[model samples]
Target: MNGTLYVGVTSDLVRRVAEHREGVVEGFTKDHELKRLVYFEAHDEIGAAIQREKSLKRWSRAWKVELIQKFNPFWDDLFDQICG
Candidate 1:
């Protein structure tokens, strides 16, 4: 599945992504097939990550797309690289 997008923050990225991919925990991602792990960032502090997630959630779609392109121009599935 290409072109689907999702955004959020998780302390356990691998587990969260797996849940989405497998539909273990049903929600928007499962319903829409939003499993592509296009972009992510590491944060030493949960507060900072939460703040960043909030900030990102407020960003315009275009801004977010641009960001993903900057870090992942190919839109390749990054789960293995990240979670492996």
Candidate 2:
């Protein structure tokens, strides 16, 4: 939790988060070491998910943090919650 923020769309949340946690993918998340999954949402359709991802990317940092805090008050890692 280095306070770095990255946003993207993923079809498989568990696999994608695992990749980030393991540093399996060489990119922004790995470079920033953004392992904690503080926030996420599921969309019924890929199109909608993509659109939402785009929207979230454009949001201000303050807005994004606020959203995350609302969803996760303590900013807890939700990886295990999803895995179990």
Global lDDT scores for all candidate models? 0.85, 0.92
lDDT of model 1 at position 17: 84
> In model 1, how large is the Cα lDDT of residue 5?
65
Q: Total clashes, candidate 2? A: 0
lDDT of candidate 2 over 3-82, digit per residue (tens): 88889889999999999999999999999888889899999999999999999999999999999988998989999999
Q: Give the alpha carbon lDDT tens digit for every residue of 1-84 in model 1.
A: 235667789999999988888888878898887766889999999999999999998998889999999999988889999865
Q: Residue 56 of model 2: what lDDT?
A: 92
In Å, residue 17's CA in model 1 sits off its true spot by 0.7
How high is each candidate's TM-score?
0.91, 0.95
